[model samples]
Target chain A: MSVAHWMQYLPIEIYVAWRYMRFNLKQSFIVALAVGIGVSIIIFIPSINLSFFGYFLEKTVESNAHIKVVRELDTEARNRQTLKTLYPDEGRILVSDQSLTRRRDIKAYKNLVSEIMRIDGITTAAPYVSESVIIVRGSQTRTSTMRGILPEAEKNISNIEENIQQGSLDTLSDDQVILGWRLADELGVNVGNRIQLLTNFGKKSLKVSALSNTGIYQQDLSTILVTLDTAQALLNMPNEVTGIGLKVRDMYQAENLARLIARTFDLKTTSWMEDNAVFLDQIRMFRVIIAFISFLIVFAAASSITSILIMVVASKSKDIGILKAMGTPPNAIMRMFLLQAIILSLIGVVAGIGGATFLIELYNATPYSKAETFLGIGRQPVTLNLEYTVYAIFYATLSSILASLIPAWQAGKLDPVEAINQ
Target chain B: MIQTDTILQTIALTKVYEGIQPVYAVRDLDLTIPQGSFMSIIGPSGSGKSTLMNMLGLLDRPSSGSLKYMGEPTETWEEKRRSQFRNEEIGFIFQAHLLLPEFTALENVLIPLQIGRNLSPARIEHAKSLLDRIGLGDRMHHRPPELSGGQNQRVAIARALVNTPSIVFADEPTGALDSTTSRSVYDLMREINREEKVTFVIVTHERELAGKTDRVITLLDGRLQSDEAPKESPS
Candidate 1:
């Protein structure tokens, strides 16, 4: 039916429904309170999930590269190995002998970096060399992953410069290194202290120029940063780099761009999402579970509303008969109850939204220091999302109206003569 | 205008309740009611007086046979149309007053007008006038629970007359009131019948109240035992 037709008798219906609700104040309050609790849960869970997800994404993207370009594997050597495995004697005779130590380095990376920098939406591209090394200070030694980076270009791709706790990264010379705060603590060294670095080629004494803490436990515990020249000299591999790190304007587009870059440059590319696939999947699953639980809570609240309306219909049957005897149509009777449901739901949703907002704000304001111990995060993560709140209210209202329908129809179908006689 | 003298007519109307054995509540009754007449229906507890009253008031459908209003057969009319006819032409008053306890006396009186459509200022004034005529002008603002039983019944009477219907069906309108209140209620109904030119069909067990109507209809065993005008003062 058109809204106009439905609204023809709405004023009177609303009047009667409002009077009934006012007359039964306690029951109406209970229904509204139940709906409010349901709404609060719906708003609270998703909003917290979104905030946590956003925080994780921000930390991951800040600490790591948006995209990484690595050297592709040698397929010719792989084919030779496959042939040797397929036919032992005959394949060994047919295959040419080749060295297994193919270089694990990107060639012409400087030119590639310049070329990739010209692409739209690509902010920066920086080449870096990674190697495992041991550090010694006063007989205390620790093993760590040492990264060799171009100071200026790496600053654009990673937030190490911003997270530097002491000294500076721009002044990093060939003989100086930046140690993670936790690594520095383990090695018993401080900024400006000299530490002996041992690699496969030779040993060198390097001075700690800076200490950085990115707030990631693993990175802080095992990372040591140095200049590209120092790392190449120490590893005895000059003019060779392992990979190129890339930053993009839009972080979400990293995967698609990584695929495009791999196809165009014949390099193996990995995006941030590919690097953290398992964690992202867990977050997605957690979101689905929270949404399901929220829906159930809302459904239970709707059941309470249904029970309340059914009681009203049963208790008001005599009034219904009197109204019918006074010539009220069945549809009008139905609309009257429906209007009551709508009013109750509206009150509930408003109250629920208000309560949820208050609770979220209170949670954010409280200073809980052991958040990392309790929730695996250092600080409170809660972002207010208007859209989720609106959706929660909408669902609560729609479900309440649907729940009220059966009782409303039953009241409408009541036999006036029997009702009055009863 | 083609006006029929009869307001309601029923021919061999029957109502049977089906169970282990069928119980006939109203059986093969032929009756006619004229315009602007005051009448009463009287019977013992199980004499089918209520069943017949319900049928004539359009609150219940007969098991078989034809019923008509103003010579137009009503058996073929839809429930919606029947409700509309009741709203525009018939009123009802039950034994227990049946006023909505949540509403004031004035609002109770305005129920029929409100249900029929939106109540205009003129209709509200008319409802107020009816309350005043029923000697409940000061009690109009009081809810049913706040008013005495007699006052609540007076409000129901005012509500019954508010729509200016052609006929009013009152089933034991004074059955719950005291003797003095019941006598005053009967006198009020008689005065309304004379002044408003409205037909009133009442069902009651009190012989004294039944004898006061212009015409009295007596029923027994689901059948009419007597239909006659009492040879006494019409008041």
Candidate 2:
């Protein structure tokens, strides 16, 4: 029979690569494990960093509205004239003293709040009255931001129920109020303790309903919560709100939604991201640094693979020569070594992802409180991002393929006459 | 004489080791191997008999020569074509047998067929039959390190014939064996040559072994000294 007949079946290159690994099991294990450690580092760093960012952002967004719409400030308004119209001889002034906007409040804001809530991605639209007031509790007086809200609609936007420690937002009434845990501590008051809120417009006695600690230092320090009727009575603005606080599903879309709200209502809008632009920029810089460091680790691991495979080529040169002498094509020789690299990398990537997940799980499982002091977060969240793991697979596989190129070429170019003698 | 039966014919074949001072490995050599002929090339060390064997086996190209295989000039063949022809028509056994240490005796025997891209069950059975014919059928799964020198050489013989090539070159086929093992290996090659009608070209320094061949060619200092038929054949 012709020896060349029925000549299609298996890929000999993979077989050879697999057998070579089986022959030198220890060396193959060490090289693959090195790649595993590198991949694990790539996966571990960014997941933890992003989790930290997520924790901080959660604390940040809860302290205020994602998008707040208010009357435009005179200093910031594009139209300095506050013109009533283009016709001046009509004797119509844009603003006059009594019945004019004293609070600069969004009038008939209930309709505006409902309108804002109907916009896509806007989860909550709660009208609020904010006033600078002096709190007097047995002569321990401090100036604080007194913010009033309709407790029913308010709890949905800021998720105030989760942060309440001493009492609950459910039982809040027009005569009751909540205080920041730190502010309550400074005034030495407890739930149901009566405190006097004195504003230039009026002074009122209110009962402390709840104390909240949102895991944010500034918000916990100086905030004084009140019912909307109480704040409206203090500010002397009835049936009106200073602003509408809008919440969205995605905080990253807050700025765009803020612009949309501004254009729709002809009012000034502020997004939390715009307010914390510098901090977010710093976080972005941190991510870039993390990614760069991961890249360096990948590059170093790939170099080590090249070094180890070159040693393999040196050790197997005689076998390569034998194959060549038997008329195996040079391309097959290259495939054998490249396939060896791919196999090793796959072993490493699986091991790496598994190891990183275990570590992250262990971290999340631990009961620890130091994260609050260190990162200003109640819990240092360590997230497992499969997206970064995909990147890990790509980086590791490509690195191994590239690392094997030179050594595989060297193996393929072996001189049969010279190598067989060795 | 180059006749119709000629399987390998070379004219003025030259191989030079070029360097600071170029050394002539094989120079101005003309040779022809007839089909189904069992022949030996014998010389002392540095006699270039090994180089001549490598060139004839198509493992190495000569610097200047016209090497014709089955009346086709092979000098201008590309690497892929040359490798294909080598896998299809030529077989080789070195002094050490040179089995891949990772593979079993059976797998080593199947290397040539695998190189030819034939892994069919029938070809595998043919490989097994060659191993059985060489009396190493039971040892087919054993690795090279596990087999004795004579056993390994026999396996090499099976490997060379598994492809059923037109010509096979054995370079010091028994150079590492004891006297008894060498005799057995030599007799096995003679048996295969006669039974399979395949041409055998052997390079060795053993005159006792060379004397049993159908013909003997001697080389000295990169030149062919003589070529003549022996008066007696192997019993």
Candidate 3:
């Protein structure tokens, strides 16, 4: 129902407070305006910072696997751990050795993939074989990393589908390949054309079925996609495939889960979080700084409330006089002023939420540079969050009550005889 | 101790304002007010008439000696007890600033009962009847600023009687009105006094109005000078 109709059911002190504010709308609006500006600042600054951070992080983690399982790092890591135990000396490690570079495959790879899939937080585990090869498009050859994949599992673990600009991954086969758009542009090859793949063991002719632009500089220029069976035959490892790539529920949990996977499955795991530690640390520091600034703004708003309520108490002393003479207790008088503070803050919370939502909508509608996008996606979702908005409301209200306490007490203690004369 | 027939009594009630030199506002004042009596107190300026009225109405405490309400001693009552007494047992009216400016006349009349949080439909009906009796039934919804001075004073009177209190202390109840309004306000109080059997103790400088009550009290320099019938001379 309407506000006036709802007001009739309130207790007497609250009713009196509403009437007092209605009698002095100009003053109440000014105080509410101060609080509203503070609240909007709290919401708007965090939203923008987190939105940009969120977009950048998505781009960093979505273009590649959260965790990559490999064989080379696995044996090296195991030897290092064994040396640490044998030496047991804090100052140095002994018996460390390096092996000649040889292409090694995870044995019983299909069985390992199934085992990795069953682990918690692992959404999917795709076994992929990547080999360095040269593409010969009319004898203009360039080296590229050719990735072989079970198309369905690779699709689940990566943003390859979203990055596809022309043609489709559905057409990819043993003889079909996906080339990065920039690489195709450099080679003067388009979809429906053929490129010769020169691997160590043999040569194969592949049709270009799709082109993608993933917004990652190296990936977009030096990567090609083929079927898993095609790469195994070319590498002459028909019974073996390369390491697995993982998709996880939480990107931040990738590091810890990687440690657990290395210990559980006796394999090495690498997380993207370890690769971009400096950037992530900087974002975390920015978060702390922003939270501190928001607190100061809310504290300033509370100070404004204290001053405003003090002035109101001084102005309304005459009303206090008659109320006391009519047998109203000092506590009731105090409650009247405190209730006004609550109502004022409630108005500010609403106005702040409304103002922040409106401004964020306008910001989201503005176009940003395509280079800053994740997976070349168009819009970033940067708006007021429900959780922090609730916190803002609670803090604003509590501070207002605390700020108005002394003034309300003064109003209550006023002598009826003196107040009336004033 | 107080007599059962008396509504209020004071034994040597005194008030002193302490400073570099003490100034006595009231001293050694013993007074007894009988139930359902219409009386008026008259004195020159600085004669403690207002001070005594304040003590009797529980708005101020006496510095020495005890006051009794309905035979109960009130010397040690806390503010909560005094406020309770003021809300339930007594009423007060002043010359101006009597009603809250924000509330309508009807709501203003409901203040005493509402302050105690004991308002019922019967109390509301009583308030409406009080206003109607004082010729303010039509203006019940109008605020004090919207009404004339006399009309507002009548509303104050309705407010003072809304709780059906045994005694109402009126300090210059008609002090701000003209002679015609003063007469009408005074006449309405006497009518309610006869009909409801409520006691009224009026403080006024107008001897002509003071002469119309059943009893007239005269004070001089914080001392009671005489107690006599309304026929006695204050002129």
Candidate 4:
């Protein structure tokens, strides 16, 4: 048939489908509702899980740094490199890669950053410096991971400024430090308070100009941010820095940018995702598990549709025989039933999507107490996102279509003579 | 070569129902009917009259014999070719009338044409003309249940004739109607046969109707008993 003819006759298909639904009202409603419920459950659980994961990822990136590039550990070596050929290999056996500590050339690292910034999409780059330092206020002392950052460069790369719960991020003097809220509470310290920081080299007294809260518990409890120059002086390493972080225009292009930086600079580079592979993999695995469980509901829904269609075919055997005897091809007969299922499924899909959207909106508007963390973060309400809602609709539509196909095919495969006899 | 004079011809046609002991439904029956002829095959139930009609209509295959349409043997015909032959050359009216309850009278008439040929404006016009000829011009929009049994059968007749096939197979076409309606339906069939020059082969146990036909073939069990042409009553 010509496209225009099919278009014109499309209503005939709908009319036929409507008559089927009307004739078999209970069966049609049961099928549609089953599909709708399946769609809702399938979409809701995973979507909520994703939103939580997204929230956690964002909090992690915000609290610590946008990206972290650390030296890869070698379990076989106590030092950075092994000259196995020269030494005939002391054939080292290792317990864990984390047990090794290695040093790299800092000047080569700076050159690496410069090369990375030359890539098309890279806009800003910064270095991070970290060390285990003891916080001493009078007689009280606690160990914390003191992260050294270049204030101006770090500001260009992350939302560090906006995430500051208290005090200004730009207020970085030589003797001033930013203490994470949980860390400061442990030390009984506050903004403008003086505390002594004892590193491997010696002790240095510094004033806390800021107390910031980054929702992550571990980071908030054990972190202290200091400027690179001041941190270099504190650690007795005049110009040494730990790793470089990059900022790109698109977050989706982070992996590509990481690879480009690695190739251009000949340095070990890692994106935020790679730096936390196990955690990301766990999130992905959880989604897959959720999808697998949700598919049971979808499968049940498809089966319901198939059963209903089989019944309809049985009941309408005489109709089919009549049409076929009038010269309706088997395919056209099949399409008619297929279209009926499609119409039923389409209604369920659209209704499910609309219902989900409404629930999500209501959930967004109805504020609930934010979850308390091990860190000293106060309660904050969860937020709704437009992007995730769109994703839910897309997934619901795809699942609905997939669920309806088998039943339609079964209906299509029905023999007109056999059907009429029934 | 096929002569235009002969509308349907069967050669050594047979049908066997398989099981542990196979049942032969029809065996080596050969027949020919000319265009515009009205013929009847009269038999009791299970005498294979329906099976013969099904074979002639391309609805079932002959077990070990061939059916020739015009001149071409149909034993080697593919599914699509058999479908095409059924669409273009054969019309069928069943005992139940078998009108699709979902469609209006006009849409029912258009069904065959729509399946056989993609619907054009001309084809739709042709369907309307057929419905009008069957005296359903006013009730074209009514569904089958809304029409009387006779009216529904008339709609089926319009549907059967929509493609203007050369021959029609009627299996108790008026079986579901009252006696008066049955007579009118038979008269309409005879009128259409005379006017359109379309051959018709009817299957029935009604002897009076059989007596009015040009020829009557009676069957006992699975075999034909007698084949006789009508003679003028002794006057």
Give the best candidate by lDDT.
1
Global lDDT scores for all candidate models: 0.85, 0.83, 0.83, 0.72
* Error of model 1, residue B11, in angstroms: 1.6
Query: Which candidate achieves the best TM-score against the true structure?
Result: 1
Per-model chain A TM: 0.85, 0.85, 0.81, 0.76
Per-residue error for A275 in candidate 4, Å, reads 3.6
Question: What is the C-alpha lDDT profile of model 2 across B59-167, one tens digit per residue?
Answer: 7899997899988998998878877777777888887758888888888888777777777788888988888888888888899999998888888888878887888
TM-score of each candidate's B chain against the true B chain: 0.96, 0.94, 0.95, 0.93
- Model 4, span B1-235: residue lDDT tens: 1238877788788898999998888888888878888889999998988888888888778898778887778889876677767777778887764877866787777666566655667777787887787788889889888999999998888888878888888888888899888887888788888888888899888987888788998877667788998684111
Worst 10 residues of 2 chain A by lDDT: A94-103
Candidate 2 residue-wise lDDT, A225-324, digit = tens = 8888889999888878888888899988999999998888788899999988988998889878877987898888888889999999998888898788
**Candidate 1 chain A lDDT trough over 10 residues, lowest sum:** A1-10
Output the better candidate (3/4) by lDDT. 3
Q: Kindly indicate the candidate among 1 and 3 with the higher DockQ.
A: 1
For model 2, the local distance difference test gives: 0.83
What does the lDDT come to for candidate 3? 0.83
Q: Per-chain TM-score of chain B, candidate 2?
A: 0.94
The root-mean-square deviation over C-alpha atoms between each candidate and the true structure, in angstroms, is: 4.3, 4.9, 4.6, 5.2
Tens-digit per-residue lDDT, A54-95, candidate 3: 777787688679999976446555666666676677245543
The CAPRI classification for model 1 reads as medium
Give the lDDT of residue B114 in candidate 4. Answer: 60
Error of 2 at A257 (Å): 1.7
Every candidate's fraction of true contacts kept comes to 0.62, 0.55, 0.43, 0.28
